[model samples]
Each structure stands twice: as C-alpha cells, then as structure tokens.
Target: MFEKKVNIYNVFELRCKTTCYFGVGAIDKMRDISEYLSKRGMKKVIVVTDPVAYKVTGAWDVVTKYFNQFGIEYVLYDKVTPNPTVEQIDEATKLGKEFGAQVVFGIGGGSPIDTAKSVAVLLEYEGKTGAELYEGKFTPEKAKPIIAINTTHGTGTEVDRFAVASILEKEYKPAIAYDCIYPLFSIDDPQLMVTLPYKQTLYTTIDALNHITEASTTLARNPYSILLAKETVRLIATYLPQALSNPNDLNARYWLLYASAIAGISFDNGLLHFTHALEHPLSAVKPDLAHGLGLAMLLPAVVKEIYPFVAEILAEVYEPIVPGLEGKPGEAEKIAKGIEDWLFNMGITEKLESVGFNEGHVEKLTELAMTTPSLGLLLSVAPIKAEKEVIARIYRNSLKRM
Candidate 1:
C-alpha cells in the first residue's frame, strides 16, 4: 500500500542482533539458553516479573520448571508494576546483586523487561542507582546478559536497546537507550498470550500499531524499517480483532506477537514520533495509566496535528486498516477518522479527561512534554517540525471529552 518511491541512495544503519525464538512453544527453547549459560559458568539468574500476573497465567511454573531441570538457581524479583518506576528498578537491582546473579531474565510485559534492562546495566555499575541511569549520567561498557520472555505483545523491550523507567518523584519517564541493554535473546510464545485479558490484548495491540505507524513515518525511516513497519501494520489490522474476539485463537496470537517484535525492531531503527513523546508524561504523572491507553487517547489528535506534513505516509499507514484510501483526496483525515472509529469499536472511546487528564493538568503535562529529552528526538524526526506551542495545543485537543 505504500506506493511512494524512496531514495535508493540513502544511507542507513540497522543493528537488531538479538536472536529471537518465535512460535507457539518458544518457551521450550529455555533449554538452549540453560546450556549456553552453563557453558559460560553462569549459575545464578535473577527473574524480574509481575508476580500476580505471572502466577495467574502459569508462566511462572513453566519458566521455573525449565530452569530447575537445568540446575540453574534463580531469585525471583516480582515487584515490577505497570509503568515501572526508578525505585522499582533500584529494588530489583539490589535483589539481583544480592543473589549474585550472572544473568537477568525479564518474564512479563514491558515494565518487567525494562526493569531487567536497568538491572542488567546496574549490576555491573556496583554503586549506581536507577536515578543516575534515568538521568543518563552513566554509560556502561557491558551489561549482564538479559533473557527476555515476552508474555505480552507490546513494547518490544525484548529486542530493543531502549528502556523506559518513570521517576515518580520527578514526575518524568525517561527512556534509556544503550547498546549493552539489548537482550541476549528473546522468546515469543503465543501460548503465554492466550490467557491475556481482552482489555490488555486490545491495549497492547494498539501500542504495537502506534509503533508501526510512528516508525514508518519518522525521519529515520529507511527501506528496511519501512518494510517491517508495513508488514507489522498489516498483521495488526488483520489479526488483532480476531485475537480480541476469540482469545483462544493461537494463529492470531502468534501473528500479533510477531507484529510486536517486528514493530519493535522497526522502531528501534526508525525511532518514534510525537505520540510516544506525549504519552510518556501522561503515564509519568498518573503512574497507574497503561502506556497503550494513553497512546490510543492521544493518537487521533497527533495524527490530525501532523497531517499536513505527513499526509502521504499517514495515508499509507491507514491503507492496511481501510483499503483503497492511500491515494484518495483527504486521505489523511480519512485515516484519522478510521482509527477513531476502530478505537470506538474496540471500546476505547474515552478521552484523556476520562483518565483524569483534564484541562487543569494540561499546563503541567505540557511543561513535562517540553522538557522531556525525547521531545527533541520526536520533533527532529517528525514529518512536521513542531514547537512548544504546537505540542501544547495537541495536548489540549486530546483533553476534550470524546
């Protein structure tokens, strides 16, 4: 659907070197990792997770069984919460160090995996706190190896070098990107996702959709990244509804997981734009809000704000969702409206105000967005060059009741 001709002479660098195992029973590959670790003389591993969800889903039993059979000792650090905080990372890091862990295993959603990334780097730093990492004060030459088992199809933290942690005291969520933090390997098992609640399935799918959309349109877009983005968008548009409607559909679940990984790889190369920059502050301030929900609430407004500059690419993004709209007049508006209608159908019809993001919070959110380090990256890669005023207006627009 993306029919535009790209410049063949453009130079780009891509570095997705993580070995990924993707399928219905990918978790079984833990034996391979166990053997790899045994060869390295690494005996202790720290598993970072959300305890309740892991236990409820039986992923804990499955993972531990594999490790136990391999004679690998592990310490469970299950304090990771949604929108993980600097404090959580610090606590996990302390536990990891105390356990004398040689490897870190992240076994949940983005929050746990991100916490593990910080822990992996902090394990080598000795005295460094997560606050120092959040502030970008220290860069590590090497990090303890990380094994990321993705239980959700969102936030490709499994394959990405980027880790997002919220500093609640500062009311800021800064994304830390370092090469050393990339997972040594990752497993994508759709069996792990069949038990996911429909709401979570919906939200995580939307998050993956945003990743594909943003990655394809950013200034960093290369032919390889765009190829991944287009396929990711197509997969999500086709299979997400099936996964939500029939949670037991393994095929749908498998594709969604694949989409999440490819989108992660795509965005890692192409980067993201204004939607992520805007949503981070919302989650940072609220702490309880899910990242995908914030993106769903804000994406329509962001699409509208940047439409004039990215009409062609936006239309291309929407083609997967609404066929035959790529070359039409007013295609961008059609794309935005299609997304809004899809969200409504998915029961994500609430606005920012429904999530406690009212006009009163606008000024504070705007200030945080303006100050966020990712704002510059977003603006630089955005199809449109947005200023502080434009960012503020987009926030205000998102606050209106749907």
Candidate 2:
C-alpha cells in the first residue's frame, strides 16, 4: 500500500467564491440579477447557451422573459456546443464585445457555462484570443461578472473557477482555473432539470459521482472536502435511480441537484486524479463523446488500477455508495465493482471501442494525455504516481468492455 507521512505544519486553504441559490423555483432569482446589474450600472448583458436544447426546453424563455421584464438590454449568443472549442469562445467573445455586454449569463450545462467563463475573461483582456488564453500566453487580471444558471446536474461549472476549452488546431483540451473565472453567482433550479433527457440525467449524475470519487481519493483531500464528497456520494447513489425512474419526482431531482453542487464544491477544493486525466484526451480526440460517457468507461478501470494504493479511503467511500460494505474484505475492489455495476445498470455498458476508440487510437490518445497541462496536476494528487506507460496501459484497459 502507498503511504506518506503528513507534515502537521503544512498549510492549506479552502475557498468557494460563488454564492449559490438552489431550489425548485430558483429560476425566479433572476430578478435578483436584474437588481444586481442595475446597481452596477450595467445595461447590456449576454446570455450564452446551447441554442436547440435550451430553446426547446423553455429555459431560454425563462431567461429572456426576466431580462425583458427587468428592461435589461441583452443579446443572446447561443452557439455553444459540447466540449466547446477555442474558436467558439472567440466567436462568443466577439459578440459580447460588439454588444458591449457587461455581465454574462450561462444557462445550460457545462459547455455553455464554460464558454461563458472564457468569454467573460477574454472580454476583460482586450485584443486577446481564446487560443492565447488556452496557451497561457495571455492572462486577464479580471473577468466580467458571470451568473451561471445550471439546467443540468453535472459539471459544477456553475460554482467552480475552472473552464475547459478545446483547441482543435493543437488537439488539446485545457482547463482554465483562474480565480477571476469563478461565476459571481450561481442558480440551481431543479425545475429546469426536469426537462433533461433520461440519458443526460444518468450520465450527468454519474459524472458527479466520478467527481466525488476522484476528489475524495486525491492527495488534496481535506476534512471539509471529504465531508462534502461523502454526502454527495451517498445522495447520488440513493437518489439518482429514483429520479431516473420517475422524471416527475421533484424531491429526487432536488437532491440530485444538491448532490451535483456538493460534488462540484468537493472536487473544486480537493482536485481530481487519473480518471479525469485519462478521460479528457478521449474527448479531445473525439469532441462528440460526452464527458460523462468517457468517465463512465474509464473510472472503474482507473480506480481498479489505483485501488491498492488507496484501499482504505476507497473503503470509506464505499460505505456510503454501497451500504453495509464498509470494513469488509476486498472493500476497495467491491467499491470499484459497485460503480461498474451502477454504470452498467444505467445503460453505459459500452467500452471505448463503442465510441470508435480502438487499439490503433491508443498511441494518439496517450500522446494527448501526456501533453495535457492538467495531467501533471492530476498525477500529483493521484494516490499512486503513474508513468506515461502506465497511463497508456489504463487507456488500453478502458477499451475492454465490462
């Protein structure tokens, strides 16, 4: 087993900078944003979103109606796509600048919210392109205020200071984790989530589960983060299936939203490990792959690889995820198996091969993973140190169906 002595004098700090308003009718809080913008003398605002889904689901109407009633001048930039690209961020930034937008509102899942974060920052740094931001060549001292309204229960981009942008030219997906990118405020309304498709609900909830699992087992795990992670795991393990079975179950939807937020806060503070490091490259190679699906395919194998080094902590996490499994023999393996079974039951039984990831693609994926800037941070926090070959092996293992 891997072990290290703790230095008692070491110092750490925790800060979740966004103020969150969460509930069923939480969308009503847009009135608060109107007042907030009015106080700041902000007239023009921009709303970033995925045009089709948000429009069909009526989330767009809810936002625009509030802006109109408040007499807030707003422009809609609804070109955001899944795993948003740098070109898309630059395009949205151009629109925000043309409209003289002062505040940004992101009303969807992670892609729109992340695009909004990148746009908000780029707006502050005049003449800087999204590519420059992704390349670390330009850093903004400030970002326009963002109000993140989450319609999905994943990617806690609503509360976190991180935003991921893909650069296809470079074939890389880099996460920008500047403090300035944190949304000024976040709204989590379960009512908006009721419209989410069953597949999305399942995938997003699993994404939240992976966030908690990876965060809890990382080197950065602290008491505060661990408490949040444990509660998040327990809630998702119990409530996710209930919400899936009956999409109209408001209570289950509310808890899933709460768990998603908690998992976001946990991972925001505790960081992540190999699961994310390995998963990012897959999506970078194939932008069409949903992040949660890639995570579902890789997490069990990654956990199994690291189980020997972090068995005790995995056992602790297992108690909440699988009741009555704590302190049992082979608890680490049992926890990993439980997660695999959960993903299988959720209909995410396909391997990387199902997504066109074959053994032939392993080299390219490994190259991308090795070059990712976040990989260094992830590996540092990982329970076991992994070499490039080890990472490649994990990718190969993910190709095998459970």
Q: Which pairs of residues clash in candidate 1, taking residues 3 or more apart in a chain or in different chains?
A: none
Error of 1 at 284 (Å): 0.8
Superposition TM-score, candidate 1 onto the true structure: 0.93
* lDDT (Cα) of model 2: 0.81
Which pairs of residues clash in candidate 2, taking residues 3 or more apart in a chain or in different chains? Answer: none
Model 2 regions more than 4 Å off:
1-15, 323-332
Per-model TM-score, in order, reads 0.93, 0.92
What's the CA error at residue 40 for candidate 2, in Å? 1.8
Question: For residues 1-402, what per-residue lDDT tens digits would candidate 2 score against the true structure?
Answer: 010242212221123689877776677777777778877788799888887666765667777777777778988888899989999999999999999999988889999999999999988988899988987887677999998989889788898888888988777887778889889888887778788889899888888888887888899988777788778877787788889899878778877887898888888898988888888888888899999999999987887778777676666675655556544435556666776777798678888988898999988888888787656677778877768788888888789754
Candidate topping TM-score: 1
